[model samples]
Target chain A: MGRFVSIWFRYLRTDWFSLRQPELKKLPFVLRSPSRGRMIITAANSVAAQQGLHCEMAVADAKALVPELQVQDDIPDLTDKLLRRLAEWCIRFTPLVAIDPPDGLLFDATGCSHLWGGDDKYIEDITRKLQARGYDVRIAMADTVGIAWGVARFGNGSLIIESGITIDALVNLPPEALRLEADVTERLHKLGLHTIRQFIRMPRTSLRRRFGQHFLQRLDKALGSEIEILSPVHPVELYQERLPCFDPVATSTGIEMALKELLTKLCFRLQRGQKGLRKAIFKGYRIDGKVEKVEVGTNRPSHHVEHLLKLFQINLGTIEPSLGIELFVLEAPIIEEYLPQQEQMWNESGGLEDIRLSELLDRLAVRIGAHVIHRYLPDEHYWPERSVKLATSLQEKPSTQWPIKPRPVQLLPKPEPIEVTAPIPDYPPMLFRYKDKVHMISKADGPERIEQEWWLQQGQHRDYYRVEDEEGRRYWIFRLGHYHDKIYQWFLHGFFA
Target chain B: MLPEAGVIMILNRKADILTELQSDILRLQGFRTVNNGLLDADLGVIKQAFPNASFPLSCIHEFITSQQEHRAATNGFLSGLLSSLLGVDGVLLWIGTSRYLFPPSLPAFNLSPERIIFIDVSKQRDVHWVMEEALKCKALTAVVAEVKEISFIESRRFQLAAEQNKVTGFLLCHQTKKISATACASRWKVSPLPSETIDDLPGVGSPKWHVELMKVRNGKPQSWDIQWVDGKFVPIYKTVSLFTEQNQKAG
Candidate 1:
């Protein structure tokens, strides 16, 4: 019979961080979160718990018992990152490992246990491996995931159950083992249904009326009747290489050496598959499980080791090896099919300069964001805003010819309205006032009629004019609506140059 | 002030071959010009702005381009002038903060508004930085920057970058606040000239510009009444004074 295993790390917040600050483990300490004007204990160490201090103890109360107590604020995000990294390390035990966030791991131990002799030895191997790494772990294997989770957290630490005895094993465990909230467990205890067996034997309609369908669902899942599916955390990169350092690397040169070795191995593998990476991330995992990572993207797919190394060389300063790094991982998130090209005797189509420009673009992109450097492709539209679309890729060519007539080099993101004074109704304005400043028109070009886009509902039509002021400065102004209208308005739209 | 040896003085109707040859020779040595040189054969058909005008594309030309503080006419004249440099296959970089030039109006200048990329840099220092980097990029056809103030050192750096990369640069300085000396091969001041009606038409005439060469680096400085007509700029004769002269001659 197949079995499911749950390994719950009870005090994830205090344990994961205390591994870095080793001195905290020896003292009575509690990770606290500030509320209003005081602190509440979020997680406590063994010494503090032994001193009768528990989670949610006020700072003053905890301090009165143990005057030498240490307090640190809880960081949920940092703890979550540490848990995921630990799960990545757990991949050696089982192929399927799902993270139960805030602190636990569920593994599908279905049939691979014969290699370690039996389920007992297999569970022992995992416990010892993680305990040696200084994590307090509880392991329980059962026929179902829910029962495994309940037994690991509430029942015996290493309770390995036979398939048929799953129901008997969960009868004595608390209602909280079914993962019900504290409120629900309190109400369940009031009805004398304090264990999973008590709740399972209740009249279905009565249980549904009081605790709702959720309580019944949890009860069913805990038994072998209903199955639960665990979603395993999958690593982003399909192609990755990891190097385990015998001694932690502290110097930049040591990191460079490790990176060089990883890249050479990864590139050779990619070459065999005729694929080149477009995006690559280099991660340095510290001994404390905190990771510092730097990623670089390329203009085109590249398999050359030197090219990829050069891209990484400019950004190596961002990675800080605090307390030294023990594991180095290089991952390629995206790969494109790129075969090795033969060297041409003559330079073809000025390809060398193009490559050099692309390299410069990549370096600049890493310094600034990739979106800031933009290329343009012309869109076939008469409206100014829809006339151009941004080219996302470097190789995009303009699909249409450039407009033959004069267009402003710069475009006002939006049109600004102006005041106009013309001697006649339909002629270009003799003068216009914009921003409270009057510009006497010395040369008026046209009442260039531009009707509203009927297909798209915009405002009134504009009669555009290319008018030059006395300073030889030209403006593209327009009258919204017809001249005969009583509410005709003028807008200064663009600069000519 | 620059030597008059390079300036083509076409103030009269008659063709001056000596002046034309000198201007052509100066242009051949890669002198920056405000107007493309005119020929003697185009005397009646086209009034000449310069004796023989041709823009030198390989060299950096800085013009101290300014206008009256009250009116916004320099943009129109520049848009007309910049049209000559826009035919290149590469894109043009326009770095500025003021959103005055409408993209739809660019079609009037025979330029694809899409071919010009707009970058809005709020800081004056960053504007210069982007301009310098863009100039050093040889792949660009031209670089145009609109700055409220430009220092001599900054303009010198622009010239050096343009020269090293062999790309043309158009630096537009807003003159509403203050006018400082700019270091460039040429300096031009443009202001609006009244339009001339086409025959007896009731509507406005083609746009006319009173272009003045305030400072010339390697060419002579002059001013003319230049007008935009038929996709090109044609020099207009001072008709009011010329008509009076003809009447006095008849008496």
Candidate 2:
């Protein structure tokens, strides 16, 4: 019960070039490369092909045919790089995607098409998205990859072959559609066997003797008599639970029930394995062929079904079961070993090890981005800005103690320059003006002189002063560099209470 | 018996029963008198204005700050309280739009900055949401949120969560909008006062503030001058009655 999709990029290289340079898209362009001391056309765009120019043709001959044709050197090994990137992008359609190489992509579409609603809409979505990105692709879906590959390139009209009907759908195609060598195809034509339908009924041993074992293997693979395994770009996650509904589920309650069931089953398996999921994705396959998914991430590995469900429930509104969903899949792509701790006898709250605390953090991280929730630890740096670093995890402890000296409670993101009048060279300012307000210094303590870390960056040393104004408000101000010829540049760095 | 004497005795008996009923209602509303040596919040004379002559826990407290200096003073005072509440390994959540609390400075208030998880959100609604959610978790000792404003309903929700979970919440609200009523147990206004150095030293001494209790649910509203000297709040001007109250309870 496996289905496959083959996407043939007819003009992959030129389309990539066009996507990079829009001006070359309309012109008849060919990518030429030097091979065997001769410049050969490696790829030609559709416009160039229409003008009787094609790949493997000499650049000189192409130029002679169309003098106004545009020529550019082909990049070495660009095909493999381009195909791999395209294949990775195709993962959104299914978890399993493989590069067909040279100019094609293979997808294991089993149970995936229903997420997009149906087969027709599924293919339509893929083709439309690729076409929107300025790529020329021909796609075909069938029960076997061989038929999908054959129909995508050579067979014309309605590339999707019905299940159990691939033979009939591919019967009239030419023998070359089986991807045979030149000698075999030529020998077949010489024997007056131009179409596959003409000689498909012949005995297998005789056919093997005529065209060899590789040719029959390809034929049998196309006809579903043999299996072909696709090496996926990214391995599928082992912690995945799937539920197929006997009837379509359209209501929110139904979706919630489906999600809860999947979570229970998944959590039970995780509990037995002594592992927990850090991130999970809940996907529902709609009857209309569209896939709706919601993702939740936790601060720590969690097998708690209720807490995880609460996190997912916050985002369940975004999933629309348009016509009704018929299938659900839950995947835990990230998992970690989680050893359960013993229950507290007196229920004393532990600091970082508290499950309730981590659950709260996880909920907060989901609502507001995870990046916004941070814990800071002191770093061994003299610079004020670099003095603290964000802890990577909850269990991280500070390597160094907090500075003993008094610092401002509020530190500005960047220091604001202030106008100061100091009578002495290194003395604290007598008066300073910030934001059109003047403050008279009543008391001061300063010239801490924190130099910039030379190994980390290059900057002038700052002479910091903790000054108190007549109103009793204290400020941390610094003068940049030296007092250059009796002139000083002071900036207000922070406020202290 | 004479009619007037009998009426006075009946009135005295009725008054005693009424007081007992009132205390019972307060206890049912999540307000229990803090016995001596039961809590560690040594807020000096300021604690006398609470319902039971002790700093209230498991409730929402609102602080209104108009200027940056006032905000700093409030944070310093809050850090002092947080340090005591966060007994050994307890943690606090400080949520706001932008972080200005320098981590290195928290040590001066007896708080390890690492123990405080900072949550910086871009929206005010998110600040309240995080505060409410954090308040519901009993594991956290306290939650502090710096927000522009909060509605009555939102504050009520926070109060309910704190009451149910026994977690303290502090809302550092900016006084940019018109002040409205909220379901907080107490409201405070703290402003910086001139610091006095010991023995007339040259530099600024320990931080001092004018702490005003603007509103309290079932207690007196009063103001006091206090200074943070060596990680504890000490009243600048001592009153005889405050000491006698503590001594009487101790004896």
Candidate 3:
């Protein structure tokens, strides 16, 4: 048998606004957003609702009805952010919490409510907590998700439906309680089917032909014949370890101890499975209902408790323990398959495969950032800047071999314009002045012309030259276009060692 | 004749004892010759200036640069040395503030760019920290860092880390405000030298440098004209003889 609970936030957006701005609790205001070429009221607080204002009503019309009505712009995605946060908090009540978008949370309360004494105390505890957080909620428990949702939103009488009487409880509900489309509900009402009780005895073939198979599916789902899956807010992390404190942990030492414990357990589990974590988060749930977290990423999959703990230790200062934390959870969101390697007799293993190398890189990344560390592989492109591509992983191999053409040891980030004296078209520069210093060329290489990849972008071709000065300092200089062209420029691109 | 032979043998033994004492002093100064033989880079006559006639592997070597050309020469020379030091699969760490070394050009020095990891840290302190960390890892063949400034204490820390593992370190100090004393095995200044093409061929040839060993803990401080060709260092004999003639006339 399955028992589910649904909690509806009647005025989620407005309640959040009032919580942020306490003055909005008494004043009549509505959240307005432009829709269909008009400002429609998206949500209204209870004060405005009592003043004869409702959702979907035009703001101008509402203003005409109530002169003292206040209109505030509605924030996009506010409902989603609010509901997700609330659902994450609701995990304290039940492990399986699913977000019912716009304003609700669905929980598979199966085998869970008994822990709080019974279903009644569980509901009271949830209501008191949400209400304390300034959310007005109506919650209902039933044997299926559909019945729970219907009872939470539109049902009357007892909120909890017994295990065997799901159909009896769903019969009194209206057709819209089945979660049918608006147009379908409108058609049903036109056919005088005001409630599920009115259409209870209808033939299955006729109902399928008239109202469609979706309506039947909903009806059957509510009656416990069809199963409805609820995807939880967080996917169950089998690699996660949790530690609950008897006395709230307030000191940094306590937090470290908790982290070490969690890491030890997590690494043990990972070792047993021959898997390792590439990314993990250390979360501390405080008594004040706030979660402080520190995250770490590794260049390679690792389950070494000391190494992973050191990575977290670098950022532990960022976590604030206000009012103390009661629970600590460490979750590895990204894991990879790993095979344990036997220790080598000699320390000849010095490359990407070395565990110590990866550990060093991980420490460097945590301290300074992973983006600053780079390894490059040869690319097929002829453009000097695009000739090398950054390797995304430690083990990535180059697709092409390094170009054999002589390239400068140090390449300027951008080509610097220089003054040049050349011998007409298609000839190397005789002399060049860069950074206010003149370089008289002693010997010069060919004007190797590299045309722009016209398919990638539009630009002029470059004629490059490897020129040596009297001091033996070589430079890779280039002409932007043909020397005979009306508009031409020379640039010192790089310095050859 | 037997007496004369005995005297010559005594003198040779005295010279060998002096060399041994010199190596002992170098070891006390923290310059460790891990392999105690010639470095794989084939540094030509340049090896004569190092203690035990071999490059120190487990200590810091500092390179001083003032101009862009000099920096380029140092990078090229470092890469050539690294190509030999880093065996087939050895990894190197190149930590600097900015990434100006073209990745594809490392192959010219006989080192695959893929084998090198480049770390571009914005702060000088972070670069030092990363260099020290990289030097401590036995898995790395060498660490090459270009920092704006390094203190005597920071350089000492780098030496300590390098000695823990037999990882070599190359520190390139560019445009530093002042040349501070450091705990390095050798101090060098590599400047670009005019290239010589084979058989009067046109255009530039192999990269060459006037490599100056300005300071060595217990060895000779000298200069050499060296050229890189076919993945090996070739001493320029013509320049050496010309320098000798000029020195003789001046003397």
Q: Model-by-model lDDT, in order?
A: 0.71, 0.87, 0.88
For model 3 chain B, give the 10-residue run with minimal summed lDDT. Answer: B238-247
**How big is the positional error of residue A416 in model 3, measured in Å on the Cα after superposition?**
0.5
**lDDT of each residue in A1-497, candidate 3, tens digit only:** 89999999999999999999998899998999999999999999989998889999999999999898888999999999998899888999999999998689999999998999998988889999999999999999999999999999998997877777787898889988898999999999999889899997889999999989999999999888999999999843478899999999999999999999999999999988888899999999999999999999987778889999999999999989988999999999999987766224222566877888888889999988998989999988898888888999888988888999999999999999999998887778889999899999998997888888889988999888999999999999998876567699999999998
**Across residues A1-497, which tens digit of lDDT does each residue of candidate 2 receive?**
68999999999999999999999999999999998999999999999999999889999999999999999999999999888888878899998899887789999999998898999999999999999989999999999998898889988889888777878877888888787888999999999998889988999899988788998998988888899989989743499999999999999999999999999999999999888899999999999999999999997888899999999998999999988999999999999987766324213556876878888888887777898888999999878999999999987988987887779988999999999998767899999999999999988898899999999899788999998888888889999888874455789999887
Tens-place lDDT digits, model 1, residues B69-177: 2123455556655565655444577777564555555556445555565666556776687788777766666777877777878888888888778767887776535
| Residue A251 lDDT, candidate 3, scale 0-100 | 95
Write the residue-wise lDDT of candidate 3 on B1-251 in tens digits: 99999999999999999988987887788655677333544676777776778877888999999999999999999888888788688899999998689987888888999989999999888988899889888899899999877788998999888888888899999996678888887788999999999998988888999988777655667788889988789988623222244433432
The residue-by-residue lDDT of candidate 1 on A352-445, one tens digit each, is 2244345545655665546556556667766566666777665566788655544544456787888878866777888888887888877766
Worst 10 residues of 3 chain A by lDDT: A341-350
Docking class of 1: incorrect
Query: Which one wins on DockQ?
Result: 3
Q: iRMS of candidate 3, one decimal?
A: 1.0
Q: What is the clash tally of candidate 2? A: 9
What is each candidate's fraction of native interface contacts (fnat)? 0.27, 0.79, 0.90
Using DockQ as the measure, name the better of candidate 1 and candidate 2. Answer: 2
**DockQ ranking, high to low:** 3, 2, 1
User: What value of lDDT does candidate 1 attain over all alpha carbons?
Assistant: 0.71
RMSD to native, candidate 2: 13.1
lDDT for B118 (candidate 3): 92
* Cα misplacement distance, residue A384 of candidate 2 (Å): 0.6
Compute the interface RMSD for each candidate structure.
Answer: 4.9, 1.1, 1.0
